[model samples]
Structure formats: C-alpha cells, structure tokens
Target: MLVPSKIQTMFAAFYVCLVFWCLDSAAGAELAPPRNVTMVTLNTQYTLCWDWDHTGNVTFTTQHIARYKLNSKKKSPIWSTVCKDILDRSCDLTLLNLYYLGIHVLRVRASVNGRHSDWVQKEFSPDKDAALGPPTNVILTPAGSDLEVTIFDPLSSNNSSMKELIPTLAYHIMYWERSVDSQASQTHQTLTSSINIVILPNLKPWTWYCVIVQSRYDYYNKGSNFTSPHCMQTEGATPWWEIFLYFLGSLVTCFLVMFPSVYSSFWCYKTLKATLFPSHQLPMHFKEFFGTSPGSDVPCLLTPESESELLCDNVTVRLEPAILEVHDLPPENLPAPLLGLKPGSSAQHSRHDSSSSGDSGVYSTGGRSNSQQPNTSQPIAGVIDCWNGLDAEQVKMQEMALVLNSRPKIPADEGIVDMCV
Candidate 1:
C-alpha cells in the first residue's frame, strides 16, 4: 500500500508548480509598484524598507509579500516580508548577510492567496566601507546613571598596542525604531556626521530605548572599518530637591569647619590688647596732685604736743588784758571783748588772778595759734568812734596801730602792709 518515494516527489513538484501558475495568473491581474520604498546600509548588509498600503487588488498580510533577492549578491531569499504592525509603514531587515560591494538591483514582490504584486525594484550598494571584516561591536548600555554608546576599536586589543587604534576615523550613526528614518518627520530625530554620536542624560526613570552606532576609519589614515549598531535602555533621574539639599548641607558644613578659626582670632586680639594695657593703670597727672597737695601745709606737719604748747604760749597769754585795753563800748566792725574781762564802761578796776587767763589762752587756745587778732580795741576818747564808717585809708591806719601794739614796737613803714584784698 505504500507509494514509491520517486512518485511522491514528482507529485509534490507538480502540485507546487500548479500553485505558482495560479498565483502568477492572479498577480498579473492586479500588479502595481510597492509604495514608500527605501534602502538602508547596515555594516555589510542592506535592509530595504517600504510600506504597502493594500491599495491594489492585494490585501496587506505577511503571506502576500516575498523576501528581497538582489541577484548580484548571490544570496537566496533570506526572509519573506513576514512581520506586520508597521508603526509608520516601515519594514526591517529583509536582507542580511548578503552585501554587494557595488550597485545591485533591489526588488520586492507581493502575492495575495493565488495572486502576486508587481516587482518593485531599486539599485543600491551595501558596502559602507571598503575594509571587510566582521562588524565592530557597538556597546550601548547605561554608564553609571546615564545612557551612553561606546565604540570598541576592532584594532584595539587587550594585549595589543594602542598605536593601532588610529584617531583619524570618522563615524556616522542613524537609527529609527518606532519609525524608519523617523527624524524626517516632526517627531523624527536625525543624527549626522556632525552630531551622529550621542550620550543621553536626564532621561525618564526606568525607561527603555533603542539606539545604533556606525563608524568608518580614514582610508588614507589607515583607520578601521564600520561598526555594528548598539541598542540600550536606561533608568531615569533623581529628584531636583535632593540635589538642592545636598548643596545646602555642604555650605553649612563649610561654615562649621571655619567657625573655630574665626573664634580663635578674636580671642587672640583681646588677649594681646589686655597685656599691652592693663585695666587699672591711671593717668600720670591724677596721681601727682591728690597724693601730694594735702601734705604741703607746714602746720599739718607739726607734732600734736608742740602744736598744743604753741597755742598756749605765755607771750600771747600775758597780753590778754592789755591787748584789749580798748575794750569797746561796743565793737563797730570787730568782735566783743574777751570772756571774763571788764568793759571800759566800768569805772572800777577789775582784776583777775594771773593764772586765770592770757591773750593766747583766751584767743589762741584750741590750736588756733597767735595768727588770730582779738576783735576789741582800747577805749580811745574820740578815736574809737571817729574810726567808725571810716574810708579805706583810715581803716588801714587803725590796723597798723593794732599790730604795732601787739608787738613791742615796729616802725610804721617797716613790714610789708597789704590793704588791698
């Protein structure tokens, strides 16, 4: 009952040819060019991208399209257009591992069930660099807190010398994930030779992204070849308030660190000033006047006993009665007569014991000394009353006479006499 293997193979081939013929006849009825066709060179391969609007007789389904088979590269159909969900009418990687160094015809065809779309074709070259090798690795990853694309020089080796990694290379990187060549749109972001390199900071927290890098070394400078694309995702940023608080705390710490030095400087100034000028040192003139003026009086310097005897000296004592020989009717501008003495009005002779008193004891006792003048004068007939209300010249004469009587005798003009105040 088992069929022969050769017969089965023949039958299968016939059935496949019949299916192809039916598809060809149907495709001929609604053939049209594919819309929005474009080509991108990635390393040694070219990915021809486009969108079919299903405007033709064919509907947009994965099965309706065939893979790209450019004849010059000697590559088979790598992958049919099998993916859908086009974000902006774009497709990806219809050809890989098939790179023609120079221009080659690129084409795509579509089929619906038994029907086929017209062949849409263009010419392009996948050789981005003349130097041929496996693609250089483009590492796109989060560096610390930021997203960065790092290019590893194929010429660089762990054990090799650095001189091989020439600095003369120029790089170009282009990428579009959500939409092919999306930078062409208002939302599209482009990268060129001038701005092809990128480092991402202040990114959204805990988000992911896709990126690519391509490089070319200078042929004249002997630079390396182009690199493979890199894709990455990154976590976002910390709160702004956290950074502000950190700065504020640092300022406070700096102030605290300097506080002790500032305080010590002030302390040193106070100590130095105090040592140079003590608090209790007084002015020179103050000490001189108060300490010495009271001691200058000669009488204050005398002994108490000597002072008492001088006050009671008998020379002054003996004259106590005679000194008042002018015991007044009443003193005009002088004091009353000495105590225990008679007035001139008494006609009787009044006498007292010699021991009773003297002019010095009566007037100069109690330390007064003989400098004091008795106020009484002798009862001159008209002389006493005549001197009353006298002018300044007559008064001077009376004073002269009194001083002369107190002594034994003195010529009127002998001693210096001062009548002016």
Candidate 2:
C-alpha cells in the first residue's frame, strides 16, 4: 500500500506542473506582441518605432542585430538591447552605430506585470530602404550674368554620407526669372553625377532669379524632395565687343577735347610777345631822345657855383602873449612893479614896442625879408601881444569880455600853427 501511494503522489505532482505551465502559456499568449516594427532615419539619426494597444502602464523593449550574423550558420547571433523598460514605443537606435550600407534586423516587445509578449521583428536595409534627403545646405551666387548654385550632401546616422553610400548621386536644379507677383517658370537642369556646383548661364542682368534643388541617385532611380525656393539678384552683364568699343570711344573723346586746348595754348604763347611790342627795331632818334645812350646824361639842376652858394636861412618865431584889445588900455591901469620899467616911459616903450605901434598891437612871429624897421612890421595873424600890459583884475575882465563879445571858433586839428590867431 505504501509503494502504490508513493507512485500516485509523483504522478499527481507531474499533472500539477503541467497545469501551471499551461496557465503561464495562456497568460503569455494573451499579451499581444508589438505591431509594425519599423526604422525611421533623418539626417544622421535613426529611431525604432512600433504600434500596440497600450493599457495599464505597459512598457516596451527593443533590440537589433546585423542581418548577416543571422544568416551565418556557425553560431547563434546575439541581439543588442536598444531600449529596455521604456514607457514609449519608439527607441533611438543611433547609439548602436550601425553600418549604413548593410542589412539590419530589429525587434520590439511589450511587458506588463511580470508578463511578456513575443517579440515582433523585421529586416531592414539602410542602404536600399533609406531615402535620399535634400541637400543640407544650398548656396546661391551671382557670377556676372550667370547664377551659380552649390548643393551639399546629407549625412547619415551610420557615420557616413549619402553620397558615399550612393556613388551615382547628382543634382537637379530648376530656376527661372522671379516675377513681381511671385510666379516662376518650370525651367529644369540636370547636372552630371559628379557635379555639385554648376553655373546657370545667360541670365538676365540685374534681375531676380529663384532656384530649387533636389538630390538624385540615377542608379537607384530615386530623388529627394525639392528644397524651398531661394532667390538672388544677378550682376550686370555687358559684351566684350561693346566694352571695347566704349573704351575706344572714350579715348577718342579725350583726344578731341585735349588736342584743341593744347594747340590754342601753344599758339597764344607764340603770339604773346608780338602783340605786346612791334617786331621791328626801334628808330635811332627815339633811342637818343629817351637818353638811354652812355653819353646822353641829364642836364644838372644846379651849376657848381650855385650848389656852393645855396644858403639855409635861420628863421626864428616869437610867441608873445598879447590880448587882442590891450592896445587901447590906459597905461595907469598896469602894475608897474611886475615888469622892469614904469609905464609911459621911453624904456618901457622900447620894451613894449607893439603897445604904441600903429599896427594895432598885433605882434609878429617872423619879420618879412624886406621889412627893415620895427614900427613898419608886417601884421601877420601869428601872435597876440595886446594882453601884456594889463593887471590881473583887468586881464580877468578882458578874458571875460573876449569870451562874451566874440563868437567861439574851432581850430583845425592838423599841423602845429599859432593858436592865438
């Protein structure tokens, strides 16, 4: 009985283990795998994305492996973990540094509450599946009448350039004259696969042009989307023959202007001497009349004897203080002590000769050369001798009288002359 019981107990434990395994399988099957696993690229960046019916804070994990490793028969290929326990369905895969020109495989699965769904994965070729992006930078330049365009290549997350991956890459440029209303024509130009910079020839001078560029891979028959229109102005254009003609015409004009002026200046210089004086020699008699000859000296203004006899006379001028009406004054009114002699005496008369003179007491500064006597003196309006005989009181009275009885006169402010006159 004990041996039978032991066998039945072992069987019952096996059945219980089978039932638990079935239950865990049913729970895993209920959790759905992620859908639409795909890789997206922009510039040099790569991202992994998927779709799922999310519920109750479920998280996701992503992994990737090289497609070539999966194809090898030697050993099991290991999958690289891109993202784990991530709340978002998308995972950034640029950190893996995958090769751009090779095939790759990526997988993603969702997990919730210690339960995990099966992984959903897909194969990807970054070379064939990746799209060619438009040039990262486009530059426009005006080359005289032509417009030049430069296209730069797009970089990839695989540490390479699109041009390196696709060697047949080229450029398609379209440009036209920009209208004021913002309309342009559909003029297209395709460049060689090796060319990145090209010159658009025969553009209008000083006009605006709009340009759009797209990258092309002729071998794959793929092209990137057209870039935004870039507008620039072209420089002025002129033909070589026209410029040469202008230069020649300018030289001719300068010659035509300068030649006449030079000729006129030279002609005037040549005739200036003749216009000022006659060309013929001066007559001999005129030269003699002008006294330019050595023997023709001017006659001396004074003979030798006259030069020795010329005398300078010493003329003395006397200034006498005489009032104008003093001659009619009585001699008894004069104070005799001040002067040397008494009045009315011969000595006084001799001292004051003009007091008794017939010339009305007017004194003289210098006598005439012909005057030989004192009484017969020239009554020059040079000195006033009449005030000499008057006392202080009488002189004061006479000054008042003179100032009252006569009109005031202004003298000239020129050279010195007698003020008494």
TM-scores for all predictions: 0.23, 0.48
Q: Which pairs, if any, clash in model 2?
A: 44-156, 44-157, 322-384, 322-385, 322-386, 322-387, 323-386, 323-387
Q: Which candidate number has the best TM-score? A: 2
**Could you tell me the TM-score of candidate 2?**
0.48
Q: Please give the distance, in angstroms, between residue 326's alpha carbon in candidate 1 and its true position after superposition.
A: 31
Which 10 residues in a row give candidate 2 its minimum summed lDDT? 342-351
Error of 2 at 383 (Å): 89
Structural RMSD, model 2: 21.0
**Decoy 1 TM-score against native:** 0.23
Clashes of 2: 8
lDDT of 1 by residue, 125-194 (tens): 4433223232255666676555666554333223332223433345455443333455555232344342
Q: lDDT for model 1, on a 0 to 1 scale?
A: 0.47
Expressed as tens digits, the lDDT of each residue in 54-81 for candidate 2 is 6787999988899889988999899988
